[model samples]
Target: MTNNQPAPDGVLRLINGYWATGVIGAASAHSLFTHLENGADTAAKLAARAEISERGTQTLLDGLVGVGLVQLHEGRYRNGPEASAYLVEGKPASLTSFAQLKLKHMGGLVALPDVVRAGGPVTDPTTEVADNPHWEEVVPAIAAQSVPAATLAAEVLGLAGAGPISILDVGGGSGIYSAVWLEANPQARATQLDWAPINAIARRLLVERGVADRFTSVDGDFHTTDFGTAQYDVALYSHIAHQEGPENNIAVLARLRQALRPGGALVICDYVVDDDRGGPAFPLIFAAEMLLKSKQGGTWRRCDYHDWLLKAGFEDVSFHSAPPATLVVAR
Candidate 1:
């Protein structure tokens, strides 16, 4: 009789997923795509430009080819379409800073086994770490990535027709979200609240975008900041909930609700999971990243958010499915 047991192909692939991550991370760290764009197509030229050994460059390039990030033809390497668009330095959509952020997280991710055994994170997730300079790069990189989503969000919220309004963007690093809204609605102004260092970045970005005249920066911890009662026409909590536990999120939501006008809306954008807390791979995997990096952060289910929003005095809470994330809007 023939054996009927299924092969563990998926499981094996999952186990080796880090191999792809490492290859991409290494390639990005070395600015390989930039080098390729600058005419270092051959491994010898790439190695010389990157200041790495020819053998190592060849091996890494082969791995990149295997992963579809690069293509090899006639003994020369070239970036694939996706890599060329998102990995090349100076490209409009370049994710170089995001790649660097991922590499920085490798330390905590590698210690995940110990963290799980100890039932907690082994590293401090607070911004106080002297060596944790990644945030400076990560904030702007993340903001750049959020531009499309922010544009979509502004459209969804109908901000263009909403007339003159005041927006409160909590934890708005780089103030990209507010800047997008202000751009879409000429009558709108925004106040962005974040830590001092991040606020500095937000200021610079807003100024660079020519929207600083309508933008205000509040530098402080959101948890203790006085948001001012009935101050904003809309309150935005973008990509923030997952970094907080339920209790903290609940408190934050209540505070934000109080800050909104009587008929204003609260907009939350994050990686939300299904009620059963299974599948939807991105959020589930991101939950692990949180556990490895934060003290009490993890992805929460949609139902959990519904309950919290309701309890926080929000009504008509609805979920919109956006690729790689979900948007929760409540009035």
Candidate 2:
């Protein structure tokens, strides 16, 4: 008896949606990826290593397998290739911060119903926190895992043939850029400026990466910092710029220009909106998250970045290949 009935859209969504969270949560709670850091193991072995009941662990492993996070061979379970690289703890690409940030902000998910009704975000993210206390812990975790983006941006800078580079990473978080660039080019140096909390993390990261000798960590409020006078060969406004209005962004770039040496470069990275201001989904989604959490929300558009850079006395501004965020570099 074949039931030839199409399920209602809402019903289908209700049944299948949110399933991904269960899989991720299971992995996080059990530290399964950390356990599997070295290699594959049977359900019993993994459960023993992770200190969970074998039956319970097997259930979660099966779920991960179903979600393509793990592979099942006989009774053994192992990380899938993607999971092994990014999800495994101790890996450079570990997504711990990504997962933790999602978990920390999961409460925003509750607004989905209202957002669906209103066709926009319901959260008011503009309320600023007086102090970012957890930044010390969070910054390091995020910076260590940011190699992919950093490497890509650095490559673009290299290809641009920019010379005598000195970068200022505002809200630089973990100083990954300094660590990576200094290692890549001995002639290059970087200043990682952020809040005191984040600088703590950045300092450790720089030291661990063996670049502390060259890299400088500046601690101050970016909104008020006097980023020096034409001292830098490059200025990097990464994930931090999108949090403010256009005026503020232009001001930051203007200040960056004042800080740049002659022919110095400026690089901007953020979730860019298309010129049409429609689609590409994620950046807009990020805007919504910013609305819900931060006071100022994220914004987009390649032209927007170029316009800001130009207004700031920059010429030959261009964008680099990047994720949802546009990477704008100028000199």
Candidate 3:
């Protein structure tokens, strides 16, 4: 909404945002979209398919309509374009797992006040980064979200139809980059570095993508692990910087710089805010997410990235726009 809209409605939407979250979560939990994609066009059919009452089903459908994810015509409901593409179960970009996983993470937001007062997570930040148990459940869901970001990065580098190359994916959660880049170039081989359990999930993902033979995993924390020197033609550190302080980020970037070959590229993807921090709503809100979860993480700016990349010995740096994330490529 524009800033000139009604003040009360804006405040209400901000405060009652959980209503939308709950509506989306509940709809996904019941497989409403998947059923709608089938023959369940009417409320009765949907309720029967979902094992819920027709009255409740209609209410849920109305909520979905209000949220712009569903459309109703002549008493028949249908999934919207986005719903059909990304919310249906088993699609390549389905976010069903990620949406449900968020239902669990929303509980953490309840303690935001305490977290803010403490200036970080009320729980130990140590448990939240490298070894978080929730990583297994959340990483797969996160993989779907990475599809466009990884694909865009690969396109930006013109990886498709290119010759043989090696990829080093640091904290490569769902192994989406490996799958995308390897598919783009059949001669390419990729290695992922992440926690053992998360790497297990990524391995399964790559296996499903039919590129398992060319994919490998390194099980360790990126903060302590040796990235090795002049090894990778391309390195990806997607969505990891927001969980780290500046020094930690620079240290990791330096390691990744050393890990790259002479002309190698390192891709850093995250929700990067503008230098002025004036607008771009999602990244601004993401800073709070970092605040609620990490000891020193927030959405960094382009200047910050440029400075860090230069300090890390990257001679060239550039930025690219990717929705829900941005790419900072350095060499």
- How do the predictions measure up, each by TM-score? 0.86, 0.85, 0.94
Off by over 4 Å in 1: 1-10, 35-57, 71-81, 122-134
67-106 per-residue lDDT for model 2 (tens digits): 7888878766778898888787777778755665555656
Give the TM-score comparing model 2 with the true structure, all chains together. Answer: 0.85
Cα error of candidate 3 at position 294, Å: 0.8
All candidates' lDDT scores? Answer: 0.85, 0.74, 0.88
Output the number of the TM-score-best candidate: 3
lDDT of 1 at 98: 80
Q: TM-score for model 1?
A: 0.86
* Model 2: lowest-lDDT 10 consecutive positions: 121-130
lDDT of 2: 0.74
Model 3 is weakest, by summed lDDT over 10 consecutive residues, at: 124-133
Please say which candidate is ahead in lDDT: 1 or 3.
3
Q: Which rank order by lDDT, best down to worst?
A: 3, 1, 2
Regions of model 2 farther than 4 Å from truth: 1-18, 73-75, 111-130, 159-164
Residue 326 accuracy (lDDT) in model 2:
68
Show the colliding residue pairs in model 3. Answer: none
Clashes of each: 0, 8, 0
